[model samples]
Target: FLTAPTMDDKIKREILPAAVNYYQKRRLVHRLNPQPVTEIAYYTAGGGCLTSSEAVLRPKAEIQRLRETFADGSELYLNFSDKPWVIGGRQIEPLGFYASGPGFEAETGRKDGLWFDWYGDADGCFLNARNYDWLMEPKGTAAMGRGPEGAEPQFANRGDAVVKRGPLATDTAVAVMREADGSRRIRFFPQKQMGFVSIDLAASGFEPAEVVALDAEGNPVAGSLDGVERGSGTLTIRHRDPRVWSFRLTPGKGRTGR
Candidate 1:
């Protein structure tokens, strides 16, 4: 079980996975307005190098569709009439705490990694709109993903193979990123010319992936490059937010550096 405080009682404690499950089970009778919603503005302060920007999203048809599909799961954005939120905004304290049995985990995973260490453990938590439009309420107020109107909506397992030929001639490294919910993930595979090719992100100012050489059957071939002619290198990208990601890459021989 977890403990959390609300506006009424910053010291109040709540139950856990049961708290989360109760809402999920009661979702059948709950629903938000069927009207369209909009994201007039959004803000974020410097929580870190990653999430420190302001973004104004005009809900496109695709974004709207995504929201509608996940309505059941309270994953959609909700209007916080009195609260002012920024992109990197965090509550002064948790709103409430909930408890769960052994089968409770977050959609992101165990939350026990170097990256999440400073984020805290078993503290307070809250449920708010995803895109952060105070006037734009979600279809449902449950704390889970429902459908396309839900947070993760379909949560569909998509598997596809991509083949491309471009500046990235050789293969390098590969990785698969799985969310805690055990649904969607992004795969990174090394390309011949480009160091790393991500099935998740496209080209950006972010660092290119560290490309390793690969053999004939697409197996990683680890070796060192001595001269500019060998044509080998590395790249890494760190995330600040969903929209902003960092990047770095190796310039081929005689090429201008980024």
Candidate 2:
């Protein structure tokens, strides 16, 4: 969370000068939209630096002093809309937060490193020195990836779908659903990249005796499926580029489907 502007504000005063010099040296523009850049920053208290007219260059030594002065005991708060707010035909929303220095900690008890809070609603993802993970509490689903020092920063979710990229190269997307007819489906999207995605279907409220994979156009794609603890199942999608894919899980033989 953020507070109103403070009185001991030398550091905040330096922002204007640094930004003016930085932008004048090199003009910046929106990468995806290709529009003339106007806004530099947006905050709760005020819209950020509007123009570069009064910009000045500060000495490196002075800048370093300010950096050290403001490094400790600082909290940055950001507020974003839960749904998309479109301007100029682009969807902009608060998507991620990155933290550094010695202030934050992971649930697993790690310290003094990078931690990320991703997502906007009940469904979102997170990455830190401790681990890379995703969770959707309302749906009772979660997933995690293992990387060296737990710095893997590639995962996202929207609603029931989870997207991830593993060590090889391929990307995978999965969504679990329960149909009106009391059957269940796990939708999978596999990209051409070289990697594998492991999806857990336990939390979506279905347990499977067998699973089958199919392409977007209703063609079967070769893959492997196996059951996990608690009668749930894991789908390992590997080395395929079917534009849209899904797996329909069959309830345990002679058991009612969820």
Candidate 3:
């Protein structure tokens, strides 16, 4: 019997490289026409790349004739350039900037998860995944490169909530939230004494509310809520020990019990 080719093999040998070449050619044409370049690239194993000009150029009736593909996992490479780019019709800035080099490879379908190996200068490669509907970094890696200032990556929809590290927040602190209930949760596991860590709760559909803190055992703790703004709230979790904490925000006054 013969073993079938894996998704990683298909991606390395065909999918990703094909995408790079397709975009490179499309970019070349856009350079001459000088139209706004689409910054986002979507890839799936079954449906190679969903956003393609070829489909757009076809007639409405013939558009469905275009091939469709899907993948077990999806990967989007953002912030290749320092210009504004649009994805799904929304303008977004590049998450990071890196120079081109050799040995650039990305493979998925691994039991551990996706693997991206590349040789380049990723000085500004750090990004906040919460800005988008679906974005995640490789596990066991920092938002920035491996450094003292790096943060632990966050996964989507964990425990009915999505947690995101603040832009300047380190791995020691985290922003936990459950969007459906419109509440905010913060926890601290600091290495040394720190003043406070401000977490952005806008992306998780957070709203201003009567904030309360809870200890590891779910008991109320003393804390405060500040810097409340439209579609955003900043919670200051101050600590000096490696303890777990959480905050809950009631959506409106006299409305209790989340």
Model 3 scores worst on lDDT over the 10 consecutive residues at 118-127
Tens digits of per-residue lDDT for model 2, 117-217? 21111121121111213321211122211333334333233222223311111133333444454545554322222234454444223456665665667
TM-score of every prediction relative to native: 0.18, 0.31, 0.30
lDDT ranking from best to worst?
3, 2, 1
What is the C-alpha local distance difference test score of each model? 0.22, 0.30, 0.32
- lDDT of residue 32 for candidate 1: 26
lDDT of 3 at 34: 29
Q: What is candidate 1's lDDT per residue for 1-258, written digit by digit as tens?
A: 012312223212322222222322222112223322332222222221111122223322112111111322323321221222222232211111111222221221111110000000121111111111111112233322233332431211122222222111112222222223222222222112223233212211122224333344534434323111221232222221222111223323453221
Specify the highest-lDDT model's number.
Answer: 3
Clashes per model (N, Cα, C within 3 A): 52, 4, 7
List where candidate 2 sits over 4 angstroms from the true fold.
1-171, 190-195, 199-202, 219-244, 253-258
User: Which ten contiguous residues of candidate 1 have the minimum total lDDT?
Assistant: 112-121
* Candidate 3 residue pairs that clash: 45-70, 45-71, 46-69, 46-70, 46-71, 47-69, 47-70
Best by TM-score: 2
lDDT, residue 96, candidate 1: 19
